[model samples]
Target: MYTYSDFDRAFINARNAQFRAQVERRIDGSLTEDEFRPLRLMNGLYLQLHAYMLRVAIPYGTLSSDQMRGLAFIAEKFDKGYGHFTTRQNIQYNWPKLKDVPDILDELAKVQLHAIQTSGNTIRNVTADHFAGASADELEDPRPYAELIRQWSTDHPEFQFLGRKFKIAVSGSPTDRAVTKAHDIGLRMVKNDAGDVGFEVIVGGGLGRTPMEGKVIREFLPKGDLLPYLESVVAVYNLLGRRDNKYKARIKITVHENGLDKYRELVEAEFPHRRAAFNGIDQELLDQIRPQFKSPYFTTAPKAEFEKAYAKDPVFRSFVDTNTATHRNDDYAIVTISIKKHGATPGDATAEQMRVMADLAEEFGHNELRISHEQNVVLPHVHKAHLPAIFARLQQADLATANVGLASDIIACPGMDYCALATARSIPVAQELAERFDALKLEHEVGELKIKISGCINACGHHHVGHIGILGLDRAGVENYQVTLGGDGSENFAIGERAGPGFSYAEIVPAIERVIKAYLEEREDDAETFIETYRRVGMAPFKAALYPDADKGRKHAA
Candidate 1:
């Protein structure tokens, strides 16, 4: 974990003070809802369906044990007893009072966390691979670069108000765990033939009503020139991106309308000028920032104990099998604490659970925690020898659910339950589906399936990339959910295909089960995962299972 510098501390304190005054003005009736909207949004406060939701940024998804403890305190003190972790690697409090938000921001500032760019049409939180520092396949940790970008983009004069919210993701590993293709800007760390580090820059990618896979703007940009190149890309989009219509305001629309070649030409033309302006500042800053992220000292611990624990304890064995990832260090493992427990609210972590995680991170891990895009908490650098003890602690906290990358590990947004923009419920749907799968014990058989649910077309849940995507919609005063299949959130990312017509709230869970059952029956073997089966067999069988009558009618019509 990178400690916040004095400069960082001062900046957050100042911002919190400013927001505090704004909150006072709003309460005092000097500011109407229209006048207060931007101010509140800038502070990461949203007036959602039932109450105000406060989204706190966990920069690059990194958190210290102290920070985690602070969040637990906030969750306990204000709003509900639990918090929802979002796909953007941020956390949301569902029932924050309007007046208490500034106070909350003040408290967050104490822990070097704030919610400034968590919302609004400005550049949002810069996300990176959750396992950046720990992943075995990583060329370099992406968090330093992400932190550099975060500093540059925060309250940036040029980019404070974009046409729409801009999102950027970076991945240090060959495997794209960060879902780079679905971001406004995606940077993948790559090494050249000469073994020099650089970024593979991709632009114009996004999801919403119009989902687009980002196109490679630059195949190889030297690590030193990252900021300048990124500056050029965002500058080009800022100038050329649509302002006339909000729907057509995204950079993806700019790329789509102008064509990739022309867009590339414009960006390339702007690059030299932008590069000169930055004048090695990015490299200089990165040189300074790199030291802050020095690898934690580790003892040459034996892995025999870990193997013994795995052999002896079934729960520990399952935890190691499902939750742990290979670390760059031979004796260490990256353990993900699944927040998506069966029948619980997706991404909701209780205050006590957060404290337990903090304690675990401090004791067994390297005092480091990461929040994943899949809504899981990660202890990034845990010694393999500590696996049993850590698993025991997590199990007691109800955090040891061995369903990482499985069907039960659902990604869901705060739909009508919390989000004012949502027309239907998302959390309940995700919860029910998880419970259904657990009851049937079908998750293990399903094998590495992503089931993302969004309240609406905004795609906050990243439903577009799920193996079995569910979109909740409001139709005629009823909550209806539409299913999509064949989607993947991986290195080989593909948007899901719609299975059939929407299902009613009462029918959606059964419909999902039917689709899964169809996949099981139609699959070549149990070895084939849901995605593999969907890819091989396509959506026809799943579609038929969900809407047999509709398929038959279409056949009759044909």
Candidate 2:
């Protein structure tokens, strides 16, 4: 974790003090709703349906144990008793009083955390693969570069306000856990033929009304040129991206209308100027930042006990299989503490649960934790021999759900429940789906499926890339869900295709059940995942399952 420098601490302290004054002024009637809207948004405060929501930034999803405890305290004292972890690896407190926001921010700053640049049409939180430094397949640790980008983009004078909000994700491994293809800027760390480390830069990818996978703008950019190249790209988008229509204001839209070649040409044209402008200052800073992310001194633990537990306890084995990933260290594993427990809200964590995670991190997890994009907490460097102890703690705290990539491990946005832009309820649908699958004992059987739900087309839930995607829509005063098949968010990224007409809230879960049942029957083997089966057989069988009556009627009509 990067410790705050004197300059970093000073800037944040001053900024929070300024926001505190602004909050007081707003509460005292010196600013109207219109006057306060942008100011509040800039400070990461949103006036949603019920109350003001505070979105705190967790850069690259990395957190120290102390920071985790700070979040727990904030959840307990400042706002609601729980906080919502978002797909962007940020945390949101949904019921904070407007007057209490400044106090909340002050507390966050105490632990080197703040909510700056979390909203208001600037570069949002720079995210990376949660397993960045720990994964076995990584070419390089991506978080150092992510931290470099964070420092450079913070209050960037040129990009303070763009055509619209922008997102960037960095991945260190060949497998794209960061959903790199679904970001405005995706940086995949790679090595060229010369074995020199650089990035495979992808631009124009995003998921909203017009979902798009990014185009590869640069195959391999030398590490020295990364900041400058990124500058050129964003600078080009800032110049030519649409401002007339908010809906068409994204960089994806810019790339969409002008074509990939033209966009690439424009970016390429600006690189020389950008390189001259950067002039190695950013590289010097990156060198300084790299040492801060050195790995912890790992100690080997005996695996005999782990093997004994694995062989004896089916429950522990299931948890290990579902929630753990391969680590660079043979003795260690990357453990995902599932926040999606059965029928509960996907990312909601009570303050007590937060403290439990914090204590566990400090005690056994190298004093480090990561917030995964899938609304779960990660113990990235847990020793295999310590798995049973960690599992016991998680079980005691209701955190041991053991469904990481299964159907029940669904990702859902705060829908109409908390977000003002939502057209229908999303939480209920996700809960019902998970509960129904768990009751049938079908989730474990139907393994490794990504089911994402978004309340509206803004695609906050990442529904555009789910294996089984569900989008909630408002149809004639009813809550209707439209399903999409064959979508994925990994390296093989693809947007889902709509199966058929929208299903009502009551009918959606059962419809999903039918689709999964069809997948089981239609798959070539049990090992073939839903996305694989969908791609192999096409959408006819799944569509037939979802709309047996509609398909029968259509066949008769034809």
Candidate 3:
């Protein structure tokens, strides 16, 4: 994790002080609601349907145990007992008294955390692979680069007021766990012909009312040129991006309206000026940041206890099999604590749960914790010998669900339960789905499935890339859900195709059940995942399953 320097701390303190005065002005009636809207938004405060929501940035999703404790404190003291972890690797408190927000910001600043750049049209919190440094397959740690981007983008004069919000994701691993394809700018670390590591710069990919996968503007950009190139790209977008319409103002739309070739040409034209402006200052700063992310001292202790538990304890074995991931160090494993337990809110962790996670991270994870884009907490470096003890602690805290990539482990936003923009309730739908799947006992049999739910067309839940995407909408004063099949958020990213008509809220769960059953029937074998089956047979079979009576109705009409 990149520790905030003296200068960084000073900047945050000043910003917090400034926002504190602004909050007072609004409360005292000196500033009207209309006047306070922008001011509040700049500080990551939003006036939701019921109450104020504060989004705190977890830069590159990294957190220390102390920081986690701070979040727990905030959840307990200011808002409700729980905090909602978002798909962007950030946390949002859905219920905060407007008067208490300034206090919350002050509390966050104590732990070196802040809500800056979490909202507004400015570049949002820079996200990266959750298993950045610990992943065995990654060529390098992406967090260092992510930190550099964070330092550069925070309150950058030019980008602070873009036409629309922009998101950037960095992935050092070839596997693309970061979902780089769906970001405003996706930086995938790659090797050039000369065998030097660089980035495959992808631009204009986003999911909302208009979802589109990013296109590769640069096949390979040198490592040193990252800042300048990114500057050029954003600069180009700032100049050409639409402003008249808020809906079509994102860089994705700008790139879509203007051809990729033309965009590339403009970016290329701007690159030289950006390059000259940097003058190697970025590279010098990167060198300083690199050492902070060096691998933690790993233990080479024997895994006899872990082996014994894996063999003797079926429950522990199941948890291990379901939740643990391979780490770069052979002696260690990356443990993803599933915040999404069956029948619960998808990405919510109670204050107590947060504290437990913090304690576990301090004890077994070298005091380093991560918030994954999938809305889960990650212990990126847990020794294999400590797995049993860690699992025991998690079990005590009700965090041991043993479902990581399984069907019951769904990614859902706070939906209508909290979000003002939500048309229908995403929490209830997600909860019902998880409970339904758990009762059927088919999660293990079903295997890896990405089921994402969004409350509206905003795509905050990232439904477009889910293996089975459920998008909730308002239809004739009733809640309805539209299902999209074959959407994926990996390196081979694809937008899911909608399957026929929407399902009423009452019928949506059963409708999803039908789709899964169809997959089981059509799959070549058990090893073939839902995505594989969908790819092999296409949506015709799933569509048939979803709307069984449609064919008969068509025939009768004919």
Superposed by TM-score, candidate 1 places the C-alpha of residue 467 at a distance from the truth, in angstroms, of 0.6
For candidate 1, the lDDT comes to 0.89
Off by over 4 Å in 3: 555-558
State, as a TM-score between 0 and 1, how close model 3 is to the true structure. Answer: 0.99
Better of 1 and 3 by lDDT: 3
TM-score of 2: 0.99
Q: What is the TM-score of each candidate against the true structure?
A: 0.97, 0.99, 0.99
Of 1 and 2, which scores higher on TM-score? 2
Over 316-435, each residue of candidate 2 has an lDDT whose tens digit, in order, gives: 999999999999999999999999988999999999999999999998899999999999999999999999999999999999998999998899999999999999999999999999
lDDT of 3: 0.94
lDDT of 1 by residue, 1-558 (tens): 567788889899998888888889989999999999998898888887778889999999999999999999999999678888999999999898888988898888888899989989889999999999889999999999999999999999999888998999999999999999899999999988999888999998988889888899888998888888888889889999999999999999999999999999998899999889988877888888999898999867778878988888887887788998999988888999998889988889999999999999999887899999999999999988898888888778788899999988999998988787898999888889889988998887778888999999999999999998999888999988988887876889899888767999999999889888998899898788888888888877888899878878989999
Candidate 1: 10-residue stretch with minimal lDDT: 298-307
- Pairs in steric clash, model 3: none
